[model samples]
Target: MPHLHDDALTLLALGEAPTDEESAHLDLCPRCRADLGSFRRVVTAARQAGAEEPGTAAAADSDNPGLQSPGPDVWARIHRELNLDDALRNDPLASPNAFAADAFDPARPSPAAHAGTPQGNVRPLAAARHRRTGAWLAAAAAAVVVAGAGTWATLRAVDPVPGPEVVASAELSPLPAYSDTGSAVVDRLPDGRRELVVTSTGDDAQGYREVWLLAPDATSMVSLGTMEGTEAHFELPADLDLSRYPVVDVSDEPYDGDPAHSGDSILRGELDL
Candidate 1:
């Protein structure tokens, strides 16, 4: 025969009455059976009053909230709200109850007596607990804000901007007679704006080449229209400062009016500053 305890009631409330072995134990233990029924009633009332749910199955999971899953200690609020002190202490699975005697009122300070306690000892442990609780709540809120900001930053970083798509082509001219000398130049204009000059001086290649402003890593490049041999000046937008656009490249263009680059790159250069 197995000994009966109050916790057997909670197991029964969770619908976990043992079928064969524990069933025989319950048959022999009238005390546990009666306690089990009371446990069911108390759990039902508690759920209806505040807890709202008993098992973890139907409760709100952090995954679907359009947010990252909270830390493992996120349920601290629920633990405090449920008043599980006695249950936590009596639990065999829980850590050993070192403060079994004081768990009820864990080292509260006497407001009237502050003279003997030095500043170090004068600190209230209960107040420290509440302070820690408040700090945790504040940290959780900050984490939520930071997580939201990080998500926004990632989306903004990946979003494509409206710009040209043509890049330089690498294939030499079909005719060997074509002598194309390509030089790409980057200059900071007087107005703090940037300018990219791609000059292709050649007998057969005296035409426009597609210009692109690439990120430092070369992972992304934005088109800046065609720079023909006849055109002397090409201006960068005032909104586009040097700090933002750091690299520039020049490529051969077919002038077919198709915006996308032909994937043939001849010359590429980045700005010095």
Candidate 2:
């Protein structure tokens, strides 16, 4: 059977009971199960970060405008999935704990609280280790689920973004890739704001990753920003032309202090509007 759709996974993430057939499939499919968990994590993290933000109102996610990175524990999961190096957690200057204390609400656990959590404690990260990850649904029409071990918190969707009309979309394939896959979605809102929501994986193991809007000929490009996690939303410039920059590229970059593309693309895909 074809893997379940994003809508189905969204339901599963919200703890909606699946249909008999869907339940049967989930029971037997660890891949689907892990994907369910991962999306759940994104939603849960989003809500958590939202609440922790000062003066944030309890409204629909779209109502809560602007972008904020997920909390430390969530980044810890990103580290585990990307198999990223230790500097993120170990850098004495970066000081994961200090980053936590100052970044958001002190009401949330300090990074030190999570410090003792042994990385060895198995979290079924992004379809499990070594087995190739299959297709993923962006954390849309989404509810957040935060789970640890056998425990999970499933929050129902208050204002799930309507499955946006995919004005232009693409499936990203691996470049020098090892089990990395992603999708790029361009959605135009009623207010005329065009947003590019990119979901990427497999470069987490590298020190850092960069997102680019590439020219089809692989010549000139525009930098979006650094992807600190696997999923993020980048607002498209009103004057920017996508017809020329129709390709999405993510590259593995080291902390070499250079702001230019490293010429090491890990994933690439062309958009068809």
Candidate 3:
């Protein structure tokens, strides 16, 4: 059987229960399971980011600020950004009936009709289903894009404008038995907090990867944090002495319940302050 479509997976992530067939396929298919997990995580993250107290809006807007609808050009901007069909250049919200009429005009010949087939042979029910599905898919995609834009705008409104600046950096070289090469940089945010940003070509290790700062003598090391992907950011302790621990090391760690480094260093570099 074919894997479930993205629309079906999205529905499942949004709390729609799967059918028996879908459930069976999900249980047996690792790829589908991973995709579903990713969709669920995205949904969960969006919900968490947008969640707010019920009365908070009322408290914040005590003056009852008047709401203004977006201008007519908003749809044009969205269409341009998404590179949507030329047929959808018009604002559907402003003239929904006309949009609907244009989308489902009976005079518009179907593909089967266009191919010189008899119009009478075309099943009206199937055509209707296809039209409905296409409309719903378009609406869903537009909604997702609009929601993403809104979320981005909200985040930009709250986040610092200038962002973080790099303070120091290092070029990581792969150690023996490894071929991965990478770089690490220390970033200082506007709030005076520092973070270590690491990026690498990545390794094919069976275990997890961890970031560490080590002294020149290899006598002391501090675990920054575990890295998930090829790149990660770790918050540096406010009082951490970068001069004392100038060496940045990335190691492959096995799940042995031991917090100590496995000593299987993949990439190592000395930071230039």
Candidate 4:
């Protein structure tokens, strides 16, 4: 079966049940399960942090009348130090784990200190300062994984994985009838199916151009279809034996109400496979 898409994986990671077909796929596919597990762990970590946070109501209900929220200067330093803007964008759940950046540093004299901050407020502020480091550290971890431990590990974690493995390639030289240059790349997908990626620098011709796999004898061919642009991806028909149809060909085709090859071959090459 083909792999699930990123959006589908994201939904599953958020604990939403997928469609019946997708649920069955998840149950059977190890790759998808691993990806879902990563998302779940991130969510759980965020929730745990939230539970540990001192309550806003508790702070409000305190007997100390002069206690104030940490100033803006404290937050600016934290954001700059940890790159929180980038982190929150990558992992929304990471916001819940955000630390109070205003950890009191005894070494640095705070403006609040010279303002004669009350002794009652000092202990709470000091404790908050200590927790700030842990908050940013947790956010960093969340962001790193969310960005996908680089492309390879990301592929290792999710569906549509690892790009296609190049199985064969061919460079097509223009025949006397045309001067265009082109190439063909054949790839083996993770599920063991093959794909043909055709690239060309030719101008769009009179009608549309078409692709084909020519027989070694040059007497038989399978029409892949009209080329839409300078590059296109086409799945090799499963039953078409590549051993017999090893030559890749491209021709200028016309809309003559016929599906047959135009017989006006412009570029051709033989595939190693």
Judged by whole-model lDDT over C-alpha atoms, candidate 1 comes out at 0.42
Q: Cα miss at 62, model 2 (Å)?
A: 34
Query: How do the residues 14-84 of candidate 4 rate in per-residue lDDT, one tens digit apiece?
Result: 45457777788765553455455555555555444433333321233447555333333433444565665
* Pairs that collide, model 3: none
Candidate 2 regions exceeding 4 Å error are: 1-163
Which candidate leads the pack in lDDT? Answer: 3
lDDT of 2 by residue, 1-273 (tens): 466666567656645556776788765443455456665765666566545434333332675566333344544544455564343342111233442243223343333346875544433322221122221112212112221111112212223333334467677788764568887778776578888877766446566878899998988999998776788789899999999999998888889899888988877888875
What tens-digit string does per-residue lDDT give for candidate 1 at 145-264? 222222223211222122221121111222233445443444453355545545554423334566677777767677787665533346667676544555655566676777776655
Instruction: Give the candidate order by descending TM-score.
Output: 2, 4, 3, 1
Runs in model 1 lying further than 4 Å from the true structure: 1-182, 191-193, 203-208, 241-245, 255-257
Clashing residue pairs, candidate 1?
Answer: 168-251, 168-264, 169-264, 169-265, 170-264, 170-265
- Between candidates 1 and 2, name the one with more favorable lDDT: 2
For residue 197, model 4's alpha carbon misses the true position, in angstroms, by 0.6
What's the TM-score of every candidate structure? 0.29, 0.43, 0.42, 0.43
The number of clashing residue pairs in model 2 is: 2
Instruction: In candidate 4, list every pair of residues with a backbone clash.
Output: 103-129
lDDT of every predicted structure (CA atoms): 0.42, 0.57, 0.65, 0.58
Which candidate do you rate higher for lDDT, 1 or 3?
3
